[model samples]
Target: MYGLLEVHNPENATSDIVFVHGLHGDREKTWTKNSVFWPQKLLPLDITDARIFSYGYDANIAHFWARPADNRLDTYSNDLFSQLNNRRAETPAANRPLIFVAHSLGGLVVANAMVDSASNSYQSLSSCIRGIAFIGTPHKGSAKAKWAQVGRQIIAYFGKSTNPELAKDLEEKSEKLAKIGDVFPKLLKRRNEEAKGRIELVCFFEGQPMNIGMIVDESSATLSGYESILLNGNHSEICKFGSRDEENYTKVVGHLMKWTREFENSGTTEEAKKVTNDAYFYGTNNGLQQHTNSGTMTLNFGMRN
Candidate 1:
């Protein structure tokens, strides 16, 4: 589901910012309006040197006639990380510093992925992610869950099928969301303990109400003691912007700019281990050239006879 959202010149990019869509959303349509994809068109002007990507996945709460679906959120979590890791493995942007901007359930995926990334097996991928910025994500149980439950029941009733695992997770006071709210903070704490700068978090919630009222209220959309912001739009449009001048777009871009600057300055999470190596000269008159990740160093020692 990791699709490259922008056709950027990878040579100039030093970092990556990936966007993931939520339930019943498309990778392209979620962030696009009137065929203008803001991440590709508007975002580059501010974050010129960062590679952009958007992830996709099947997010059906209840399949018609109980169709087979991957209903586990943890499975989605694993897939997101695994697919992203594979995509970047051989690319020029392989080890560039990474971050995320996710919406709705996509935000949950990002959090769970990051939580999984903390383990030893994923150190390489985890070390590169500096932060995540969320838009209208539910960090707590939401009012929309009841409707989701009803919808699932209706689908099951027609098909004579039972509700799937995903339906239960979408209910208010979802067992999964509870665990994420509890464990996500602990994951960030562990990252900080590793001496790699602590992962940064920025959350956003919709200020305006839909016909159904605030599907995810402020308390549900944001976490306590973290940076939370307001977007003057409904839940569906909170993550979409048609132009660079929109207030929501401006605010989102402003946060992204700040993140890029911070990541540019934070340097690598892993400190370079100092090692001593003997220099060897192949010829009487030769230059010793040492190569490094940032650049090259050369020392010339010669005699003109």
Candidate 2:
């Protein structure tokens, strides 16, 4: 079975949160730093009422030999849906309100899983998803994907073989990625309109660049009708929180609190409707940058220096 590590599962919790790591990321190492796993050590401490889980799959960057078939995003999505569905059947509280936290390509997997769940026998799983937090997800594709493809091709030319299909899917204008981008929003809107509960979304984009340059630019990360926050870190660093005192950690917790509150009140009160409506129309005011050191948050739509 694909790795499904439970970080924390307190008895009598009302909600569940799952984390999906990006490419080349392990369920444990993806969110760990200096031997401290934030999902276990920090997140559960803040969001004490929910059970936390981290999902893992085969996402290695390089392969010495080419496989018989191409492993597409849909394959990953199917695996995720199957695992979650099995859990829901096994655990009594597993079907409770669910929140997803995904990074990079994992975000695409989550999106596809939601779409698949909505149309299949697993619609219940779609309904249980209350919120999704995306970290540097390439909704519109990214330049780094092309760079990765080039690197893989170079390696293959030298001697070692690699899976070109996976790399090709990451291209900015690839048909696979474009199809997902087209269908995901429509599916989400339909789900929101049909269900008594609403699925809220929030995106966090990395402001700093790494050795491979900006993996996902601001344009590729932001989604319509969701709050997009720019944090002071690179692609990988954006998901790694060393301490609770860090700005990135605090912002993530704040969004989770808002989602949890809205989820709890969903379909029960008129105030919840207002909250959902307000969140739908929440404007960025030309965008904003939050400074954690000076404790200053300002609206600046222009490029970040």
Candidate 3:
């Protein structure tokens, strides 16, 4: 089966929201707390006019030894495209305005998916995206990644086999990670220019440290121009909301509510008609434009784990 799972699909919905989980995260469990999945139980209650889907892929870093040498971000992006296309074929509403909520390495996968969409085969899927919410995504390299590599070495020394290849991929200064950081800005610039500010970006960073230390710091989690919100949780906890009463849950829902209102007000069908297929590949040489200073907001719920 395709790794895409439909969480809440309302009949009168106007847009589509897709959630992508991070490394070692399951499609359902990643966004759940106290036996309740937020995307299904809470998000639908707030943003009623959009269908929700959670995209899953094999994100096990420990299984890197079993994967091909060429298996990397591009491979994951291709798989994402295939699953999305398969869904589109089965349901025509999949073509509606799209928004992405990605966590950790899932952000990289989404970025690569957008890049892949510039090619002929995936243009439609790329063009459908209107907004993205990045939760604790390491846009730059993270110190925790380096520590993961060291931890793997320690495991290997103790006669426990581990995937060095995957460890290297997560390392702070790894060439693979650096290349993604370099190219992603250019891709965003091109996409933003083509969309004429129609595409929106919001980043959410963790305020607390993970068990292994901070997996993604504020500097690594945020992009330069977008609005970055600091939530009161660690890397994993940032995505998990126990109930609608939590401030973290409110912030996420508020963002989506705003996006959906703007989407419907702006006229979705008309906007889609305006975008040409060549819009994806047309603006490679344009310099990145300065985004209006939307500024950053730090939401301190004062709840810590």
Candidate 4:
């Protein structure tokens, strides 16, 4: 199976955005829906001449739930690369920048795709990936996988969910998810380190003041030489483009616009580093741009320039 895709063509555009979604998410649900889709919000920005593309993959949740976890890597990674190659081929060869806006599991796919592109292992592709905005990516492994393992054990004990796909997947992967849980800490740490310094890695984390303490500080989330911004909301609401939260949706749009323009003007690493702890309210552009109540990071586009 392949992922869904949406290409908003603008002839002779200088930049193109490729959108990727996370687990249990498809092209439309993650990028197109009016409720919280990113493309909708980004389209309204003052970007006069740009193209937007949504990259979907064969990340069928049912298959993921049924197949072994590692099996997912084998299945999805190639398609991820293939989708990017196809998109590049469709481009008009203007040597423009490509920006990836990925959510959740989509971030993982984007990373793998970049790794593949770097190796030149994928066919008919170019290393035009400029910047990335990872919204609530588990650059660290997910806590939910632990819960899923517990649920699987309970189901196994009762011999429940005996459907063939479920049964096969459980039999194949029951042991692996547990081991994955055990090694997740180190794995996540390594992933965080490996991810930094590769292009621009912008991570967006949740900070709704949950009783569970899910949000980590900016140091853990921020990458070297890249900027980070925290918003005020949970994981799900962080991606809401036009959300009433103001901090994430409204304010983020402004920051993103500023970052894009700046990146285009002077390229990366052109700004002075000034860590300011300013407070601003929602509804105002300055309030949204400089506010830090949530956990989201963005790496401005144009690394190849």
On the 0 to 100 scale, the lDDT of residue 269 in model 4 is 23
C-alpha lDDT of all candidate models, in order: 0.68, 0.70, 0.72, 0.51
TM-score of 2: 0.74
* Candidate 1 RMSD to the real structure: 7.7
How many collisions between residues are there in candidate 4? Answer: 13
Which TM-score value belongs to model 1?
A: 0.75
Please provide, for model 4 over 8-59, each residue's C-alpha lDDT reduced to its tens digit, 9 standing for 90 to 100.
6666355667777766566766554356555645564456455777766765
CA-only RMSD, every prediction: 7.7, 16.0, 14.2, 14.3
lDDT of 2 at 204: 96
Candidate 3 TM-score to native: 0.77
Worst 10 residues of 3 by lDDT: 276-285
- Give the Cα error of residue 223 in candidate 1, in Å: 1.3
Model 3: lDDT equals 0.72
Per-residue lDDT for 1-305 in model 3, tens only?
A: 23889888887777889899887788889999999899999898888888888988887554221233544667777888777777755544545788999987788788878866777488777877889999988775334454355335333432334444454444442445555567777777777776444578899998997555667778778898889999999888899998999999888878889988998777555545344111221112333222223532343444444
What digit string (tens of lDDT, one per residue) describes model 2 on residues 142-187? 3344434533433343333445555443443244555566788888
**TM-score against truth, every candidate:** 0.75, 0.74, 0.77, 0.59
Best first by lDDT, ranked:
3, 2, 1, 4
Model 1, span 1-305: residue lDDT tens: 34444445456676788889876778888999878888888888888988887777776544211222433676677777777777766453445678889987688777877776666356677767777888988765333443354344333433434344545545442445555667877777777677666777888998987665666668777876789999999888999999998999999889889878876775644431111122222223456665445555667776432
